[model samples]
Target: MRPDLELVANLIQTDARVLDLGCGDGELLHNLQQHKSVIGYGLDKDAENIGLCLAKGVNVIEQDLDEGLGNFQDDSFDMVIMTETIQSVHNPLLLLQEMLRVGRECVVTFPNFGHWRCRLHLAASGKMPVSAHLPHRWYDTPNIHLCTFNDFEALCAHLNMLILQRRVVNRHHNERSLINLAPNLFGSYGFYHLGRTT
Candidate 1:
């Protein structure tokens, strides 16, 4: 598992129901089913990834997340997880609302747009940053709604969601003292565990 996924896996309770949005190849789901005994289903739009999921004996569905997760009923799962898929979605606010509606909690991970490297690159070259973390150019990037940690927290506040946990880490998903000093300026990515307050 990716180090970030390792962090995500830690947040889950054993034997819980989970829904993984934009699950690329069912790696996390497979790991969860084996180690945590989690009952989970992965959702993805790519046919090849779906094939890989089936091969792994993972329960998966083919679907575009941008449309909505309407096929699932309310409070259907214990947790809803979306890793690195928020920026690509059409309506992040609605997606989050739906996630919380269908599950008691949600976990989200995304590249930090407010990192110092991105800011420095933009200010220096006057063009969008194209680095290891965000390798795509502006014209071809799948990320449509890139945002900062502060931006996401504000949105959560607007929706009355409670932030259960938050972590800012380097590209390797490792935490260092520098990152803790000023996460917005140092950390390359962010991981958040959230829930409805009400």
Candidate 2:
């Protein structure tokens, strides 16, 4: 398993029902099912990913997140996870609110566009930054709403979501403690545990 996934799995509580949005290949869900004894469901727009997840004995649905999740009732799951896919979505804030609406808690992760290396690249090279965490050229990148750590936090605050935990991940997915001090500039990626305040 990837280190980032391992970190995510560790954050999840045992025996909790989980919904993983954009769950690619079902690796994390499978691991959670095996070790934590958790029930998991996945939703992704990609048919190939859904097929791969189904082959691994995971329950999956082919659905676009941008269209919204109308079928799920409020607090339908214990936790909803959206990892590395938030930046690609059309309406991130609305999606996040929906996640909160449908689950008691939500785990979200996204590439940090304001990392120091990216800033340096922009300042020195005057070109779009490319790193191990975000390795795509400007035109071909799937990310549309690239955001800094602060941006996410602000959104969370605006939506009245309470932050339970926050972590920064590097290229190898190693968690970094320095994130608490300067997440927007230093962290390459941001992981958050959130819940609705009211």
Candidate 3:
């Protein structure tokens, strides 16, 4: 499991039901099921990933997340998780709302576009930075809605969601306490635990 996913697993209560959106290859779900005794269903658009999930005995569905979560009823699960995928979605805010609607709480992680390295690289090279966290060119990158820590917090406030916890990690996915000094500029990735306002 990615270090971030391990951290995410720590946030989940044991034996809870979880929904993982864009759950690549079901690694996180598999970990959650095996280690935490949680019941998890993964959703991914890729057939290969779904096959991997099936091989691992993890329940998975194939669907584009941007299409919306029409099948799941409100408050159907204890938690919904979207790891390192929010930036790739077409309408992140709408997806977030749907996530909150279907689950009591949601966990999200995204690459921080406002990291100083990205800014400095862009300033120096006059091109998009291709680092370990964001390793794609501007034209081909899937990250459409890239944002910073502050931007994400502002979005949460705007949506009237309650942020239960927040962590800033480096490119290696380890929590860095010094990053808190200037998370928007220093953090490479952001992990957020959020709940509905109500």
Which TM-score value belongs to model 2? Answer: 0.94
lDDT of each: 0.94, 0.88, 0.92
Candidate 3 lDDT over residue span 164-197, tens digit each: 9999988987667778888889899999999987
Q: What's the residue-level lDDT of 142 in candidate 3?
A: 92
Q: In model 3, which residue pairs have backbone atoms overlapping below 3 Å?
A: none
Instruction: Summarize candidate 1's per-residue lDDT along 100-159 as a digit string, tens digits.
Output: 998999999999999999999999999999889999999999999999898999999999
lDDT winner between 1 and 2, please give it: 1
TM-score of structure candidate 1: 0.98
lDDT of 1 at 53: 99
10 residues in a row with least lDDT, candidate 3: 172-181
Candidate 2 residue 61 Cα shift, in angstroms, is: 0.7
Task: Flag the better candidate by TM-score, 1 or 2.
Answer: 1
Candidate 3, 84: how far from true, in Å? 0.4
Q: Which runs in model 1 stand beyond 4 Å of their true positions? A: none
Candidate 2, pairs of clashing residues: none
Ranking by lDDT: 1, 3, 2
- Candidate order by TM-score, decreasing, is 1, 3, 2
- Tens digit of per-residue lDDT, candidate 2, span 1-198: 977777789878999999999999999998999899888888988888988998998888888989997889988899999989999999998899999999999999889999999899889999999887788999999998998988889999999999999888766666566765777887887889998787
